[model samples]
Target: MKHLILCCLLLCACVAAHAHKPSDSYLNLVVEGQSVTGQWDIALRDLDFAIGLDANGDAAITWGEVRARQSEIDAYAMARLQLQAGGKSCPAAVTEHLIDDHTDGAYVVLRFRALCADTVSELQARYALFFDIDPQHKGLLQLMYQGQSSTAIFSPDKATQQFKLTQPSRIRQFVDYGREGVWHIWIGFDHILFLLALLLPAVVVRREQTWQAVDAFKPALWSVLKIVTAFTLAHSITLTLATLGVISLPSRWVESTIAASVVVAALNNIYPLFRERRWVMAFLFGLIHGFGFASVLTDLGLPKSALVLALVGFNLGVETGQMAIVAVFLPLAFYLRRTTLYRRAILLGGSILIAILAAGWLVERVFDMKFLPF
Candidate 1:
């Protein structure tokens, strides 16, 4: 146990020893007629984006023209947008982001308007800006003339130009879910943590729960299977509800509560909390994580036609990720079970790490700052 704990810390230390890699974001813009919508896939790559307004709003605007309009827009518009790189989480991604607006798909505030001034509506197009994808970004847009909120998803073909929404709007024909579903499954940090917490108990065999809990340390894979199955089934149920708009929760509260669940799960690990029916815990916590999944679809604005498909795809991505983790951990835990040291080290060290992470998250969310020094 002691050696494994040391090894884990040493591994983390070595990784942290290197400069942390920056996060990249890719935003896909779909401007249908007059309504403009943005979808992004947050990643480790620098952000690339395009303001794909399908309108000929302008004839042409030079850098000078765009720079000049900046002030006019600031003065006349009720809202102002400040361009920040990366996302809301990081403030100084300035050097990392290489922003350009002179591309074929780039939208120039004045140039586009100038080019299309003669017409009532002209589609101004700008695509392929390599930048970060931030969902809560609003300042970039000042006022939407007839912007309608809708959801979008990438076509399975992956060749379609645009996507459609769950609820058909009065004006919008197609919506853009873009790569957000895959993106969330990939970068949703909270979802990852919840899975990790639930995963911990599965890796070990409680001496109390099994007659062979400590045998060659290969107690039984059945426990892990049961837990994973329960989690998958439970979350899938709510993921649908949350996505379909049948239910909802305050984002902050849901997120905070998830962190809290991790703490509880970790505590249980040190001294079995859900001793009888782990499924109950799985079902309850899985519901919360499912809501986290729903938020991604909710943000995209589900399409009535694509709801089932979107749900299936996103859930599949999640299960794939979850199953991948199990595949990695199960073998390691199985091997370690042979040694007395393995069980102690894994439970103690794993529990501590989970608790620390969950507690840090709790402080970060509840108090807006870290309660403990890093």
Candidate 2:
């Protein structure tokens, strides 16, 4: 019991740590012969953390403060990025500095130009932004060369990458997007909580107003299959539609509803709603979750040449990630289904905690306020 309590606490801490969207910076670079032009959109919150942006310390950062610190910002940012063209270093300079708003928050946009010694047939970029302080920070890159677009992600482990100025590789794009899909689902706390909330009862049966462990593993496995399949199918539909721009919804509305879904799903675990047909619930909410997933791909901007492949690869990767979570959870949960630790502590207590955390997220997202640090 004591060990179960510790594990639950650790889980809650992990969730809270990643409750908000992970830090990401958008880097769009265009290569034209020996010249390079691009824009880097970095979250102001992240910038403030790296360097003191608030001059007056009133918690509000003004243009005056930002403008005054432009040189520092440029120096700090440029030092982290290096570019090369045709085996020679291409020196970059900040041509413009502006601010823009994203779905999450405001960002500092740095527009820059670089000149190379020779024509750029290939481009090499080394991105180390924010990796020192935050290992989870990712640099989302969109590279354009000779009217062809290619995309890549820069992480702490994979900081430097080279791109050919000719055509993009279909296999590379598929694998990259697939890897990103897995990463996104892993970091997406609301999605994970919603799925877990549904899975918590998969190993047990509701009978006579009480829960009982399943007599055999087959029933539990079947229950998980139905729920996972329903969620996969529903989310795949919306993910495709939303990514293709056939359907759209306001980001705030989508995000708020996603949080609300987590709240409802967690509460249902405690209050006993949709006892036998939780898959139906999974399908309905998964449609909304798909929209949430679309936001990441939409921001990444699919490669025009390999659109279908990238989409399919990413969707398959999501399923792989989701199933990986289930693989670890289902067997252990089944093993402990008959224990008080599983029923009362994990199912009831964990659900209550999830509900409360999600409720906080709902209020924060809807009100556009930050009540929690995450």
| CA-RMSD of model 2 | 1.8
lDDT (tens digit, per residue) of candidate 2 on 65-92? 8899999999999999999987889999
User: Can you write out model 1's per-residue Cα lDDT over 1-374, one digit (the tens) per residue?
Assistant: 65566446422321222111112222333433433333333221121122222223453334444444444432322121111112211111111112243111233221111111122132222222222243322111111223433332322233122223223442322222323444454455545545555555554556745312435434346666777888888888988887877897876677677778777876776777686356677778888878767765554444455456656766776777677666766666555555545455455565677677777777666654434432
Worst 10 residues of 1 by lDDT: 88-97
Off by over 4 Å in 1: 1-183, 208-213, 216-219, 368-374
List all candidate RMSDs to the true structure.
12.4, 1.8
lDDT, candidate 1, residue 28? 37
Which regions in candidate 2 have their CA more than 4 angstroms from the true location?
1-17
Q: What does candidate 2 score on TM? A: 0.95
